[model samples]
Target chain A: MLTIENLYVSINGTPLLEGINLSIGDGETVILFGPNGSGKTTLLYTIMGIGGYEVTEGRILFNDEDITHIPAYERSRKGIGMSMQRPPSIHGLKTRGLVEMCAGKRTVDVEALAKKVNLESFLDRDINLGFSGGEIKRSEILQLMAQRPKLLLFDEPESGVDVENMALVGNMARELLEGPSEPDAQHTLHDLMHERKTSGLIITHTGHILDYITADRGHVLYSGHLCCADNPKRILDHLKKYGYKECIRCLS
Target chain B: MKVDLSKYEFTGHASEKVDDLTRLDKGEKESMKMAGFDASEKNRSASFVQIDHNHAFCKSYDPGVEILPLGLALKIHEGWGDLKWKLLKPEKDEFTRLAADSTHGGYVIRVKKGAKLTAPIQSCLMMHTNKVGQNVHNIILVEEGAEAHILSGCTTTLADQTAAHIGISEFYVEKNASLTFTMIHNWGENVEVRPRSAGQVETGGIFLSNYVSLKPVKNLQMYPAITLKGAGSIARFNSVIVSTENTFMDVGNRVILDAADTRTEIISHAIASGGHIIARGHIQANCSPAKGHLECQGLLLNNGIIQAIPELDGRMEGVELSHEAAVGKIAKEELEYLMIRGMDEEEASSAIVRGFLNIDIMGLPPELKTEIDKAITESEKSMF
Candidate 1:
């Protein structure tokens, strides 16, 4: 479970996210719908404890504990993982090496993970260096799958991903939410699928994510304010029909 | 049939021909003599061989080898005579000044064409007095398709004294030949070293020189050049200099590409602590389709100074030239990360420094690489 009470974030003394309040229950997926510059990234970075974003006046509670000042790596070690929108290219650090590092296990079967994510050919290459857009996205997913965090944050995962790999990524996302059913099997196809206790908060602007997985609830974030929380299909259809103009008008 | 110049102001009168006939003036007769052909004694052609006053104590470990001081005739008669050494001096005016005051120990080494010499040609110059001076000349002529590896080292044993060591080494890599020249210098704290070395490579030849300095002297000024004159020739220069304790080092390396499809590469590394180092590297591609590359990197440990200047000059439009120079201290994150991984601060720092220096040494021969690694490790232990 995650909770934020009156979160305020600013960059260079300019307010980006003002008086934001939200919460997510256990095993629940929350979709954050907002237009450009609506503090979506700032909010995600604030929750993930990145970007050096100062929490002017707010408290972030994770699993009923105050973790507002936790560092990124510590937060990651505490069952919190984030898939960045644009990951940094780390030279000489192989993808498998990073997976093993983040997994914190020397005996991790990296070859299997690579094969699962279709990155088996590039396992020995540098981490995300010269990888295509889709390959980078898949690498992010592979890292998340290895981390197996309790609360996952996806920052625009749909951006720049081609249609051919979108289904595989979408299915992987679905499988990560469900628990692994058969643990004794050699290949853990259902391992990520059976892990049902994991929750996620996805940020999307195009609303094309509605075709992939079932979002439990949707919240419209406009002008640094959470206007309303409703059904995912209803909100996505409303945004598709009227855009953010109507949402801003409703806020006024 | 020659006209006299009565109105001209001659700086110095031309001397008579002495025991050395290899120092003929720039003319057809000199060319013929350089090609090992006998000249007509009837014409009485004049030769200018200006021998210096400083005597070179000559001795050879092998009985078949001959070591001469600074005479060109003894050098030629002993089968060490090749025309390449004559062209290494500066112009006439500059050559005279250097020759008159230069203390040169001239050694001629001749490996027959296709002959392989396993033993390195070793030489040493001892500056035993304060304000001592040394100018050593070494000529190594590897005939066509021959191969050899020469190891030359210079050092000073005494302390609290000022000394100068100027060595001029000329190497001729003939057609289809290969040569590796490794020069290591560990001068004392008060010695000043000015080494001007040059080498010329003929067609299908390879010349590689690796220069490394561990200790810091008072001053070091070196400009070593290699000219690739024949097509498909290659020249490579790898140099590393470390200075500390108020030392000043000025090092330069240049490679000239004169024939088509020639290739040249130069890599320099400088590490300074409580001193200053100036490294200049240049690669000039004058012929079409030639390739030139230059890389110079410096690491400053303490408040000492480092100046890296790398230049690439291309005259032909079809040539490729690239140059890169970086000067900075060790990265803090990398240092901290290495420290956290069970290495002490000194160990971590030395590891970082060794990594920086051994980057180019990675692709060297295994034996040479092991020697370099051992040398750096010993130096690092001594520094700590």
Candidate 2:
């Protein structure tokens, strides 16, 4: 559902994403693995239309529509939602309020969403302000659930999340990908699985996501280039055995 | 340059007495009475009844308001009933006894203990002629354990020069009472407005005042003071002002903590776009264990100027006092973030402005909050 061709992005004249190309079909979950400063976040931000990540060359197409120049909120309105690795603290704005705002609805069943993400106690608190690391991750998951976007982008969703709730985040992500299915399932699957229309591009370095969701493919981004695309479990196991040096050598 | 008052005092002069003393004189005292000055006329009788009749003026575009002459007629009637009017026919010992006391205006409104009013009482004053001067006095008395909200708005229709308005207001809050006063002024470009207001609070009473001005005026000055005279009394003042087109605005608030355990807070926010705004706030704690604080924040939208001076004085050793002032343009990072979120430049700026002023509106009534939100939206549209 999303395509990137020869995409080159830079900030302050420093190249971040160089000649990157990738595409994700409907109902596909693609995990991006890269070390720190390997253009993983830059690529996610470029896809999300955040400012300061200028596209010097190439184009990003969402459902075959060129969205290189689309604004961030417009991108959100067009069914592109992202969970930032480091979410911003918005004082005086309740977490539920922001979720409702993003959902484009007047009222929200905040309690249900909070329960889904295990954030019932913090729903009335300021948006991610004064929250612990785990709380922020949970809040991001709640927001993602509220947006219910066509294409979901998760930037380090596992980071700072507690071990116990990490499973909840993973389950929530899987449900979002699978689409809503039954009422009493405890975890409702997304309809995207049946229609094969929803997709996700998750950014991670740990490969821990393999424990929860079924990732279709994995790509290693090194020094601003997509080195390879293969089965996520296989690539992650290979990286664990050989480390990034082998990946870099293979890329060169 | 201290004058010796010991030898300057002399016996009463009979020549100062006028034959027609019974009639209330019209100028300052009459204006005060009209504005609700309630003091007995026995004190300061000479300055009480002097009417500034030459300055009387009125204007109205609507027949109802113009024909009613509510503003002018109210002033005249109030002046006629003030303590100064009684001084004209002083009754020897009785007049002397009353003279020593300060008489507030005649209109006394007392909210019963524990009574709470949800709606705001709105009062409007307007000016229509050039070279016209006005003086008015108002008094409000809130009884023990009561709560009240008062809204006063002023506007001028005339564009003529030399239009002036002088207003005075006094408020009294008994123990455990709470009072909120909101004032909004939108005057013509050439009008000069001066308002002096004071409030006294008894034990456990709370007083909150918010003053907002959105129009460009030739000159505007006001000093609103609150005195926490009872233990556990609390007072808070919040003000916002916007000056444009070479206009000038001078506004401030003074908070005095006179009783032990009293507390006061003052906050002022000003925005200047091609004009000048000067704001000052002072908090004084005179009794032990009293606490006072003053904060002033100013934003310069254009090349215009803004000055804020905040002061705090604590005379008692155990009292606490603090002051803070900040002046700058909107933060660039915040602006860009909002802009990236679909808001244009003007919208971003106004959003921040609205956020800055929304601090106090949280306690306002829903209807008033909606009105302010609409006003901010309209102003944002105009800027765009």
Candidate 3:
């Protein structure tokens, strides 16, 4: 669903991401683990086509179409959506109205959807204004659900959320990637596979998200390089024991 | 600032009286309706209509409220002298001087003591003749334990006809009384306006003022102040002004928290599209346990300019006063946030501007609310 070849990103002539090649197949969800200032966010933003992240030398393809030169808004129109970690607060723009806009041509029952996230009372309020950490995450998930994009990018969904909110956000994130389903018993890693589903690229630092949902693969971004395409649990276990330096020294 | 007193003819514009406002012609009625005056007087307890320098219509439908012309009220009520030009002195400026000397027709609206009139009283000051200078004095009194609302609309008869309006209004909120005054200005592009207004609130009284001006005007300058003189009194001011192309506006508000436990607040939103606007607010807390807050925000859509001045003055150590002022274009982050939601740049900017102008006031009539929404929509069309 997504492809990148030799992605070289720079900000005002300062090199940020260099010589990066990554691909996520249809119905595949890739987990990216990176330390602070490891170009993880730069990679996601470059994929989303945000300003200030100039692509000096690279080509980004989604569904076999080159979208490297498209604007951020055009990328959104082309079924690419992002859940930013720290979204800006837009005063006077109600959250419900934005959710409806995110739906596009699709009709959405906003009140019913807001009830799923316990945001029924916050529909009329300005989006992201004075929202708590958990509320912000849930609001982001709610927007993505309404948008129903084919390719979803999650940037640190576990940050700033408590355990209770984490459970809710994780389940919601799962439902967004895989189509919605009725309440059922917990699924093991064996039941995580699907023939065709929404594609996702999630950025994580703690890897606590691995306990909630299944990931196709886990890769570490170190010094602007992708390394160690292995099982999600094995990579997390190795990072917990040996840290990222071992992966950089051997896995690359 | 360059208004010539001799250029406008103050006399010979005395309009004939009309007992029923519905009898007026279609054009005049439409213009007045745009200024928030309902010719049929629907949802209004009382009304006063003044054309040029004449009192065309004045009446009261509710027994609890009294509607009288300023000239007649002064002749009958001897105590009018004490209330006239009491809060704002006539020697302060040329506009006040003209209003005091040539005092034409204005309204004297008074709510009886202990009376609570749920419906608002309406007043329309119209410039029907060419280059007419309308100088008027208005007084509003909400007696003890009374609650009242007054909606005043000021406008010119035609879009391009030149006119000038110099008005002096004094308000008094008695003990335990509540008064909400809403003013809407739909002036012409060639009109100049100078309004001198001041109010005083007594013990346990509440005074809320809302001013909205959406139409174009050549020049406008006003700074209305309200003083909380007694303990437990509260005052709030909300204003939304748009300076369209070729217009210049210098508007502000001042609130004084004088006694212990008194509170006051001022909030204003100004938009400049190919025009200039200077938005100012000042809050002064004099006594201990007093609180005052002021917020002024301005949005510049084009090459137009905006200047926001918010001042805070604390007379004593125990008083709390704060202010916030911001003047700039829209934030890029906010725009991108909307764009990601499938809105283009133009649609996103329009939504932001509309929201910026949507200020919530206490007692806004439905008609006025619709007018404001229409005004915002109309202005946004020209902006993009």
Judged by DockQ, which candidate is best? 3
Candidate 1 lDDT for residue A32: 91
Ranking by lDDT: 3, 1, 2
DockQ of 1: 0.04
For model 2, residues B256-336, the per-residue Cα lDDT tens digits are 899999988888777776678888888888898988888887777767688887778878799889888888887665554
Candidate 1 Cα lDDT to native: 0.68
DockQ of each: 0.04, 0.18, 0.60
Task: Please provide, for model 2 over A1-252, each residue's C-alpha lDDT reduced to its tens digit, 9 standing for 90 to 100.
Answer: 899999999999999888999999877899999888999988988888875689999999998999998777677767787777776554345666566655665466768988887888887676667887778877877877777788988888789878887887777877777665454445434433455456899987777767888889999998898988899888888888887898778887
Instruction: Quote model 3's TM-score for chain B.
Output: 0.98
Q: Residues B189-280, candidate 3, lDDT per residue (tens digit)?
A: 99999999999999999998888888899999998999999899999888888888999999999988889999988888888988899888
In angstroms, the error of model 3 at B216 is 1.7
TM-score of 3: 0.95
Q: Candidate 1 lDDT, tens digit per residue, B19-41?
A: 33334333423322221122232
Give lDDT tens digits, candidate 3, residues A50-149. Answer: 7568899979999999999887778888888889899998766789888998898899999888888889898988889999988999999889889987
What's the CA error at residue A157 for candidate 2, in Å? 2.2
Cα-based lDDT at residue B38, candidate 3: 90
Scored by CA lDDT, what does every candidate get?
A: 0.68, 0.66, 0.87
Better of 1 and 3 by TM-score: 3
